[model samples]
Target: MSMTVARRPHRLLTMAPAVLALGALFVIPAAPAVQKGDDFLTPETTGVLNLEPGECFTDPEYSPAAGEDIVLYTTCDQHADNQSYGFVHADDGPYDRVALADFGWTSCKRGFVNYWPGAAGAELDYYPILPTAETWADGDRDIMCVVYDPRGELGGSMLPRAS
Candidate 1:
């Protein structure tokens, strides 16, 4: 199960269509009342920023121009489109698309390795959800690292189990 990695820029106009088609775009909305480590028995629409590590969700519908995206949180035991592996924070600086991408790439790759230490050969792929300039100005600096199986839905949590 080797890992495949890809980077998905957040809300860039040029890449918006590709991001939406890949279900990588997450909408901004009133934060959902979900706590970290909670299991979502049923799907619920929420902003991407609301997602926490280990949470599983369906691909969200995003309107780039509207500055919105929606992800449906679901149980990891169920088949889902993507999972939140971890998050990275951009350094304190003016938003530079290229700089952000580079930071996200390096951070996400490192996070992925730490998250799945022995799963280097896992059949998984990952990408980062970076903040757009608008979102950055609005004080959104999170880069979410998402893991998914390119072939289809993830049937269960990829986190290694405790012995």
Candidate 2:
């Protein structure tokens, strides 16, 4: 799939071409060896489709020349730029960028409300990391809904706390 990652502008509702590339200053190494009985081991770089709900990560950085995207997983308690809230699968159909984006936007919006019911009045915003034509052709149909605090880094997960 060429390792390209597409992202919409943070907090924007308009539909635009999904050709923007996220850039990072440094590259992280591959996944570390896991210890016995460990619950989870986050990889240094991963596609958006691999992120699970409530997992925190830095925004992915991509270089068009390199045709690669790098997403660094981080602990929710630490400072991070985004968090996976939910995922939506695109319906079976021909590859239409607009159609896919429309479906993703609508679905992810509903997911955002469901994931964080109290976010309507907050400064938090959500964006979707969608599949490109290359990725779609390779059977990638998942859209990841990610939430972030527009003001700065998120100190914790956006998932609602238990009562």
Candidate 3:
């Protein structure tokens, strides 16, 4: 006499969504604390002079206005609400606020798309942290490209997701 054997079906595709949901929950605890303000120059922000490209941080009160002190810096993989894509230098001599603003706008706009190719129409937004007229004369000409989520607070790096 001979016996027949039966095989079990795999549930890989059916389990995908559940696995993804569980994986996402891990980063939820790392979310940065959101701070709102009337303007970006709120006293709540601690001044940080040097923030390198790919660095991540949280701005309790983020302001697009130039000249404000840098905000608190945090780990990109940990408690980061925002990240810096890159820095662009301004034109030499006769530092002008208007010209700097225009340059920052153009540079940041280009850099944003480069860093986040799939960002078009997404909830993400970016702005440039440019030197104020006073700071510019003091030799501060770096324009920092910053990315953040306006819809809500974020807890992890925004880089890998774009890809």
Per-candidate Cα lDDT values, in order, are: 0.70, 0.67, 0.69
Question: Looking at model 2, which ten-residue stretch has the lowest summed lDDT?
Answer: 34-43
Query: Model 3: which residue pairs collide?
Result: none
Which candidate wins on TM-score?
2
Candidate 1 ranges beyond 4 A from true positions: 1-46, 62-69, 117-122
The alpha-carbon RMSD values of the candidates against the true structure, listed in the order shown, are 21.1, 22.3, 11.0
TM-score of each: 0.62, 0.63, 0.61
Candidate 3 per-residue lDDT, tens place, 33-94, comes to 33331234322245545567878877654456744445667887666767778888877889
Tally clashing residue pairs in candidate 2: 2
As a whole number from 0 to 100, the lDDT of residue 12 in candidate 3 is 81
Cand. 1 Cα-lDDT: 0.70
Ranking 2 against 3 by lDDT, winner: 3
lDDT by residue (46-142, candidate 2, tens digit) is 5444568889887657757657766667888787878888878888678887777678768878977877777754767777777777777787777
Q: What is the lDDT of residue 29 in candidate 3?
A: 67
- Stretches off by above 4 angstroms in model 3 are 1-45, 61-70, 161-163
Lowest lDDT sum, 10 consecutive residues, model 1, at: 34-43
Model 1 TM-score relative to the real fold:
0.62
lDDT by residue for model 1 (1-163), tens:
9998887655598887787877744655654332221122111234566788989988766657656666768888776878888888877789897888788778887977876665544566677777777778888888887777665677899766777
